[model samples]
Target: MKKLENLQKQLGYEFKNIKILNEALTHKSTKMPYNNERLEFLGDAVMDLIVGEYLFKKFNKIAEGDMSKLRAALVNEKSFAMMAKELKIGEYINLSLAEENNGGREKISLLSDAYEAIMGAVYLEAGLEKVREIAINLLEICYPKIDLTNLVKDYKTALQEITQADFGVTPVYELTGSSGPDHKKEFEIALLLNGKEISRATGGSKKEAQQTAAKIALEKLKK
Candidate 1:
């Protein structure tokens, strides 16, 4: 077995009970005496509480709905996977021969679960405050890279909310035209509100074009 001392070094917290750390890295596919599922469950809840508290305190004036969205963006599987990759958690993960042969080490779901399991183990061996410090340090590294504007839901939804509130009607998107080859095509889209064309934009796909149009419309509406 590879040494976990490097993982502990990366985490900046050494486990007094190293067995717990091993269990955290063990997947169900390994058919070990103990696996990470229980630890993952605990870690999930711990993460939620920690992230929610952080966001609540940090974004004091932000609306609850917006805060919820930010929390979701932070605690999501992709975010966890990114953190796991940064920590090289995959290197320490224990998988069966079949799973290893099938490239289980690079699987995002497994990495994310293992990350949470490690957190749970950290909490168990240390305490909530210790785990919280580690989690916050990881999140600090992650938070700045995230673009909150892009993380907001599709532009159409934002446009709909603005139109509904201001005009008591939903905005509509129309495919204006397309150009180029099918594989590399570009689409043009227009946004209409209450039967009046508000804005138009182009993108690499119909969805992207529509979003661009909606974003343009939103900019116009906000002016």
Candidate 2:
């Protein structure tokens, strides 16, 4: 209860209905009668609507396909997980002993789902504008450069172009390691340039890990 109150302070939005807030932080792993599943469902819809509206109004001239791509890039597990990490949502979630032992606190999907439930709880209590204010602020802070070229840029392609121009060969991404359960595996990628490890990164998927490693390589190579 004290931690929940502190979470409110951290969120900067006090809840009139703390029950919803508690529900939002609850996971099904806890075997509770009322978990965050329903809240997560509501939050998922809320996130899409807010982001769709934001993109629509912000990028009036952009085509529908591009907007869809942008939304896809933003409204996903990886993105929300990162934001939830920032808010320390993982630390506050109610998980069972077995789930906790399995490192559910650090699980991206759990964090993502909890964050959605948080949004859902906020929206239910305070409406769209209030939740939008909170979500957009977090989005901008979490993703400082939120635009078409920035969000949709193919870092892997860009890295290849640079590598080819300089080394006359493209960089290679190799899976160095993987961890977590099968359903929530995190892939580790090593970006190799001319057979030397240039950078390494991890992500929810291989492609994501490769892209992230490529992005890191691009930055260092540029410098």
Candidate 3:
């Protein structure tokens, strides 16, 4: 509770219903009665609205597609997790021992969901205007960190360019394997150039895997 209070001060928003705040920080894996799933759902909608409105007003000259892309870049799991880390929100999150042992505190999905839940809690606490204020404030903090140039590149194109420029060979991607339940399966992908492995990455889907592979290749080459 002390941690949450500190977080509220840091975030510039106080909850009218403290229970909601508590619930927002509770992970579903704990099987807690007041889990954050519902809040996460509502927060997802609120986030889309706030981000859409911000991008629409801020980038008036940008095309709808680009605006949408920017919004997506801002609201994804990776960005949300990064934001959560910045806020030190992970310290306040409540998770079961099993989850905590498995690195739930640092997990992107949990962090992102917690971020959404906080948004939902804010919306419920003070309405859209207050939520908008917090959302915009956070957006300001996040905007500079978003690399739009890198965000705009497609995986295949980016990988090709990197491999071609770096090693003078076209990059090839192979579906190494996939596993898990249908709803939450993971895919492993490997990127190769000139018959040598450049990098490998895993993701929830094949396309994501390719993008992650490309991102890994980018990091390797950038080093």
Q: Pick the candidate with the highest lDDT.
A: 2
> In candidate 2, which residue ranges exceed 4 Å CA deviation?
155-223
Please state the error at residue 7 of candidate 2 in Å.
0.9
> What are the RMSD figures for all models against the true structure?
10.5, 13.9, 13.7
Which is the winner by lDDT between candidate 1 and candidate 2?
Answer: 2
Candidate 3 lDDT, tens digit per residue, 29-71?
Answer: 8897779999999999999998889878876787888887888
Q: For candidate 1, lDDT tens digit of each residue in 1-223?
A: 3489999999999888888999999999999889999999999988998888888887788788988888898998889988899899999999999999999999989999999999999988888999999998898887765444556657798889878988899888888899999899999988888889999999998888888888788888788
The C-alpha stretches of model 1 lying farther than 4 A from their native spots are 145-147, 153-190, 193-223
lDDT by residue (17-87, candidate 2, tens digit) is: 78899999999998999999999999999999999999999999999998998999999999999989888
Q: What is the overall TM-score of model 1 with all chains considered together? A: 0.71
Cα misplacement distance, residue 87 of candidate 1 (Å): 0.6
In what order do the candidates fall by TM-score, top score first?
1, 2, 3
lDDT ranking of the models = 2, 1, 3
**What is the alpha-carbon lDDT for the whole of candidate 1?**
0.88
The global Cα lDDT (0 to 1) of model 2 is 0.93
